[model samples]
Target: MQTQGHDLVSTLDERTSNIRATIENVLVLPLSRHPSPRSVLIIGCGIVGAATAFFLARRGVDVTIIEREGPASAATGAADGAVSVASKRPGPMMVAALSGVALYRELLGDGTLTDLFKPRSTFVVAASDAECAVLEAHAGALRGEGVAVEMLAHETLIARFPALSSNVRMGAEVKGDGHAIGYRIVNRLLSLSGVTVLRGVEAYHLVEAADGRIVAVATSRGELSADAVVIAAGNGAPTLLNCDGVMKPRKGQLLVTERAPALNASMPGSIMSGRYLLSKGSQKGAEVSARGYGLVVDPLVTGQFLIGGTREDSDARQTNDLEAVRHILTDAVAMVPGLADIRLLRAFAGVRTAVIDGLPLVGRLPGRNNLFVAAGFEGDGICLGPVMGQAIAAMACGETPSLDLSSFDPARFTSLEVAA
Candidate 1:
């Protein structure tokens, strides 16, 4: 790794140059002419921020993270931990999801994420005729995208997984999906990185140099100086970036059941309803409503079942309404009759930041050379957080990211008036 004050004026690699050239809509601003950063300040301690700090620390850079609360106290601690590509549409997000999952595999192999990631298949089932049609088309799309898929008829589905209810007409097994608890990953990354975290501190604004570089941050405690800054605070990012109105908070409710080893072992992997395709707008011609209900019954390694949830536009993280809970449980029981016998252990809700355009805001913030942003991933954050962090850390060090990040560039939003 290069030292501080090192000049970074190397030509782009052939692959990177081709990707940059293909990106037509983004502003394509040049990296700062200043030397590479010696110190980096991360504005969130969630999974994304933690992962960023981890990569930066690995590169021998001084990294410090500031969080409004304890690590993973917000969305990261409350997520379902599904590192899945089965629910993604075939677009930039899908491409990113594939890369994200691949990174998870790499981290697992390198022991950075040992026992933190659990690889498995996701079985999606359809109970009604309409859902069956959607399931078939979705399965075809997944195969077209080179995703390993197997269509299961009613008999084969029930025989292979007797835990499912008789209502399931058909199913599709999506391979290469996995699950990991969000808070666990955050803690592991922070521990491995050995970076200091300022809990209970909040950043209010960015301080800029005369040459339009972000040199410091104004926070509740005081002003902290750094060579570079990254805003990964989800919804909290819009205000600090001074780029409001681009992202909004979306809420989801989930439930956990008591140990049911017999039922859990009967299934080979997590079960997703065909409706999830429509809810996520993965099915062609499907519209994503403000409030959508999708079912996913995940069997945890602890012999418990994790069931979820409703996607509501409002940001009500502290409360789970009775209507949503009842509907989710009803759907779960309908899909798996044995679930009706298990006792409910807990019900919780989380608020995730979602951009209006669906894609997350990553890479350098437009017009702010030393500033970067990686937030608004919505539900995909758990899957994409680490990879996006790796990309941001590379950018902060004046290197081209391995993945094509032009699609997620913050410069795509013209109305974003970011003031230093």
Candidate 2:
């Protein structure tokens, strides 16, 4: 297993050599016009923070990341890595999700993520009449956005994916969706950017100057000053920004299964349950409860299966309850009966930070020019992390972001009044 992992790493290194050289050349070159924030401090080491540091460093800005835990020790380390837009509605989030997917593809082409990203379609399946109806409308929305989608009838679905159970009434093959492991992507970005990461440091408060600009961060270790500050610390942001009411924790449980090469190979892509749309409140009339179970069975490159989980309005991250695990597996096995034979390997949970309004906070704070917030992505962090990081980095440098972030501006939460 170690030898195989080493060989895979070597192959990826070879694949990324050309692009790595180009990026390194750009990094070594001095910038003609110095950006205002010559030095920036980021308050997280998750994927979003790592990506933000990478983009900032790439633009010749000195970047330092401080985290309460090690890299990917929080939600980023626990994500399912679904780079998908199939679950989003036709709104700002959907648009951002599309851009996020494009960015992943762009990174892959440039060898920045050649091996880390796996491009494949997401199959959203329906097992009931009500589910099929919701799925049809969802497919229409995806098509309207020019997303490649194939609405499969029951017979066609059975023909295409024989591993799926007979209970699957229909399925929609949403192309351009992909899967990636969260921790791997975070590590790669950090390695490529080569920025300083201060682990085991807790960021407590933001030190502001009389001019209403964030000048430093008060940490557990000591006060660290910087030209600019970014609060992307997930659950930690609400306290630092004094907007506790704006962010809440949503827990999710995920499971992994032992290797099943033949069963894994049978599926072309990850399987998303139609009920997941309802659970995520993607359907207009769908009501989301305090606890909802959404099924997603993803086949990994190592011939293992990744299944998940329950979305609960709780902050319990260290433990997974039997009820949630049982419900998730029941749904997963119902969709793909072949999973019944596979032994369960592991079950873990993570608490994702979600905003009250659903949309993420990804732009400059209301009146703080050098202060930025990029948290509250909920479950979409894995998909939006890198792209939003690049955008936030641009915003910090007083440049145009790759994606329009007006919809996600931090000013939306009026209660978040930063102390000057």
RMSD of each: 8.1, 6.8
lDDT of 1 by residue, 1-420 (tens): 532211211111232233323222222223345556766789999899999987887676667788999999888999998999888877778788888999999989988899999999999999988889889887887787788999999999999989999889999999999999999999988877667777998988887776887767777877776778899998798887677788888888999999999999999999999998888777657876878998999999999999988788855565798888899999999999999999999999988888888889998988877889999988899999999999999999889999899999999998776555
For candidate 2, the 10 contiguous residues with the lowest summed lDDT are: 23-32
Q: Which stretches of candidate 1 lie over 4 Å from their true place?
A: 1-35
- Candidate 1 scores a C-alpha RMSD against the true structure in Å of 8.1
lDDT scores in order: 0.84, 0.84
Model 1 scores a TM of 0.91
Residues 81-100, candidate 2, lDDT per residue (tens digit)?
Answer: 89999988678888899999
Clashing pairs in 2: none
Residue-level error in angstroms, candidate 1, position 170? 1.1
lDDT of 2 at 26: 29
The deviation in Å at residue 165 for candidate 2 is 0.8
